[model samples]
Target: MTLGRTSTVPLADLVRRPELGLVVLAGADRLDRPIRWAHVSELRDPVPYLLGGELLLTAGVNFPEDVDGYVRGLVAAGVQALGFGVTPVYDEVPASLVDACVRQGLPLVALPATTPFLAVSQAVGVALAAAEHAELRWLSEAQAALTRAALRPNPLPTLVTALADLSDWWCALLDDAVVAKAGIEEIDPVVVHMARRLRAVSGRRSGSTEVGSWHVVGYPVAAARVLVVGAARPFSVADRAVIAVALALLALADRSDGRSVTKMLLGDDPHEGYRVVRGQRKARGDAEIDLGTGLVDADGDRMRAIVTTVPDVVAAQTAGWLLAVSSPVGVGDLPSADREAARMLERAVAAGRPVTVDDGVSGLVDPEAAARFAATVLAPLATRPELVETLRIWLACNGNWDRTAAELGVHRNSVRHRIGVVARELGVDLADTQRRMELWFALRWSD
Candidate 1:
């Protein structure tokens, strides 16, 4: 089977090769890092002259009196293991070095006197090149798979599946890492670490996981990163590039880069297209224009177009035309131009319009979604039925004890007591903005 480019043959796999005449003091299964090749040398203090993972070969020209120090130096310098070739100068593996290696947990191979060091080094180098070549072949296959998928009328699903197969792992596409996707139920620690690092480095969401024997790949879609995790022993390089290309294409398609017109009109970056304007009330700060829009003063025009003359834009399956407006307005302003656009789009779809947008879009969405999300903060108190609803009401009233008490038909002191109870149950800091935002998002379900 073709392997992806990101794949590496495990070090253990190399050890399993029967033709190498290689001796194993260390097992072949170690994959903590990659071995570039094997090295053969005659120096006693090879540490100074050597790089790590050399599969070191030495004839012990100046064998150490204090072998512990020598072994420590090798390990410290990143040597994977030691192979001592017995020669006339040192006819047997030194007892001191062997003891030191065993004590330090470094792998030590006893090289046969009849076997030349060159043979061992040559064998390892050949294996490494072959492994790398195999990875390239795997990557070529992945590219072919993508080409086939792209030829399909609807390529999203096919492309995603092809990615999964190439990585040899289960995968999930995310609009935001926070938002979960189908077939990806949990985020493993390794995947999370890689995702965060890649996002920080690339300013794009990406992640990979090595669960048990398999390697997983994750990258962004919309605002989220797609997670592909499998049980293969190692990941190939080609697989990594394939993932990068696949995600890039997804972003190009304007699907997972979080560049929704809603996001843009709300003043988020669209990467390559569209512009967004946040209201003074919302105050997200800064404006964005899509490079593809082909306009100067793009944000300004985009705003004007939406409010003064344009029709609503509809999402594929959802009802209503999508419209965005700026400035302050009360939550009661539902069904305004923006809301109407959503409604109109829904109606148009009901008729025959593929999509529509309206310029008069303005209005606050019902806060109920956010409120319900916030109520999740009280979920832990589910066991305390007497206090659950009361806690929700207190928090809902903006932590106003008097108002909460009035609503709960109880005294202010009782409201305060119940809030304390709720706070204790939720295990959240009432004062931290981040924590509060989580609760708020849950209440509004917007986050």
Candidate 2:
């Protein structure tokens, strides 16, 4: 197990500090071990007072008879290194202590008489705080980079690049094979097999192993999709956190990331009929949502997808979304189905609930009476042909200013202005769901 946090300075850090004048005399190769703290202990047996990972400093005030036994005890107590101070008790580090440390593989450092043990302790504390601060700053910046990558046009590839850039490690997204990768040109066969093995096993979300000096790890993010990353060194806690964030974002945007609607529709069989769904977020902006395993394309408040099964309207509403689902149609009819979903979304938004295109309420009512009532309610919009057409198109688009504008080949500001005019002319607050529902019905019956 590791001794301390990544923020804790290693034994080597103390020796490199010019002010400390500390020199490594034994176990030089093991200086990378982290020092949790530094303390002066002149007792012959300081192991009993240790809680592990300490750089125990002493001036040989009370030398142990058995130096080998003392070094072994410190090792058992998890003392990372021993620092000898040249003072009244000794002009230099004892040859016996140095030999015992080398034989036991315990790190040893010699402190000059000019440098007090207290200064070494203070320096260790200051270095630890600085390292911790640097790690936190790095974590925050790395998370921000991932967020920005997620918003890109091709999020999956961009995310892979971001992970590679931040970690300086090879990152790849794997399905049956590598879907996207960075930091390496070709993937090792062993890495691919490990990813597949992880997918085959049940309840195995993540696993890691060492291969030929490379530390490789894999995590299952979605159905049949795995994110694999490799580096020369093992991953730290912060590194894992950044990868988790990327995996979660990738999972939510899986089928649709850099993929097209056609691929989603033909996922299983080309002959299979599919439904087009549109959803409007109750509260807009970024939030995680499950849109099913289909070709999903989400742009802020509006989301579109081609799904095999009909969506659960109640579930969508419960999840804070107003959903609209179209009737199942073949691949050739997807275009028409999307328009149907768009129109359904308009009603769902106005009614402040979920709506299905197949829910035809017009036939239930008397057509003549409904038409008469519709004409009376819509008479104000009918006098101007543009307003009548605009109202119809606008209602078919769920009051989305941008979409309404795009359909009418007008600017979004123009669409907003026209909607304001209709609201004022009818003397009703468009913000009211009941008013919008009434207007939707009037437009529906008029058509």
Candidate 3:
């Protein structure tokens, strides 16, 4: 088997070996093409077995009468050169075959009577093996360099630069948009478009497509994160191995970076106080501003910020984000704030605006207690999702029958009936404002 394109030996190198006793009779200028292997075949039609870049040898034992057709077939099969042995068959290279090879631009090699085809094959084999060994060594060196870079203070930029250097191509780490790039001033629009397309299609770990003269390959590093490479040609097996190493390193760096951010956010540093925000759109600001404001995840869907003063709900609403804000708390209480922010996020999503929590629900005591109370109170309607949803909407509308019906896309009488069933099943009076208040808290906390 032949090593891939990256580790191929040129046909001229093989021809230059004096021990092979091979002479190029045609296509001298085309000797630079890569030679994958030296294949021996005496059959009249050996094109079916060829995989391109082979130096085909023959003794003329089964040489076809149509010399032009034979040469054409070999060219079509991507045979790098034709070696005619002059011992057991025609004693000399035929003029017809030489003319045909010259016409087809296929290099013709004359194997002398004393030189065996096996010698040339062995030389080519040894050369290919050496090339493959060198390629592997290069890949190993590149992997080591990338690993070292990954351990540096800023690993992402280092990894990107190392990958581009190793591959001799531009590389980019696409976190939502272009987060880190190297070997190129600006990312091509086609690469950006392909990155977005790959992100949208889940389970597709890797893909390749053409962009202008460049070949673009993309690998999904994480959810909403992609690694893109642009090169003049397709990547070789060795190139792909290096890319896989870089991807793994990048993933490790991301996990470690996230943990570091989390630790800093939750540390007991006296100046540490932050809020976590989740939204559907990417945050807009300067790079330094973004870094100072918060750590935005690669997906651009979430951020955690260190701020002395919390942002107002009105600012979030005006920006068209379903924002959730947490009350100022100590590092130890940040986890509780996260949960409170999550609940507020849910409420904001439902209300199509922003929600802020100064201190979580006062009447519910705690989430566990509220859950237990909801189980006891709403167990009767547990199996009826429609009734539970109606109850929730009805409570959210403050017992307004007509508004609840409008929201549920049902008649006011249907809302009234579901509410009546809910009250009777739990044996509670719906008209009692105190009971309504308790039910509302239960619904909100349980959800």
Candidate number of the best lDDT: 2
lDDT of 2 at 384: 79
The residue pairs found clashing in candidate 3 are none
lDDT of 1 at 241: 70
What are the candidates' C-alpha RMSDs?
21.4, 13.3, 17.7
Cα lDDT tens digits for candidate 1, 1-447: 235533223455445556544465543334334555677666667778876665677888877777898888888988777777777678778878777887887777776777777777776667667877877676677677765554332345556666666654666554335332334457666766666665555454545556766566665554444444454555544556777676666555445223433443443432322212211111233222222221112232123223211222333113322233333223233225344434433333233332232322212333344346445665686578767667557557777878888887889998778767767878877666677556644533322
Question: How would you order the candidates by TM-score, starting with the best?
Answer: 3, 2, 1
Candidate 3 structure quality by residue, lDDT tens digits, 1-447: 232237778888888988887888898998887888889998999999999989999999878999999999999989989899997778789999999999999999899988888898898889988998978778778888887677555688879998888756899999677778998888877788888888888785687888788888999886478899888777887788888999999988877787766665665566766665544332453111122232443234444443335666565555544466767677677677677676666555544555555535632144456568878888888899898899889988989999999999999999999999998887999899999888887776566
Worst 10 residues of 3 by lDDT: 285-294
Candidate 1 vs candidate 2: the TM-score winner is 2
Angstrom error of the Cα, residue 229, model 3: value is 1.4
**Candidate achieving higher TM-score, 1 or 3:** 3
lDDT of 2 at 281: 92
Global CA lDDT of candidate 1, please?
0.54
What lDDT does the true structure give each of the candidates? 0.54, 0.81, 0.77
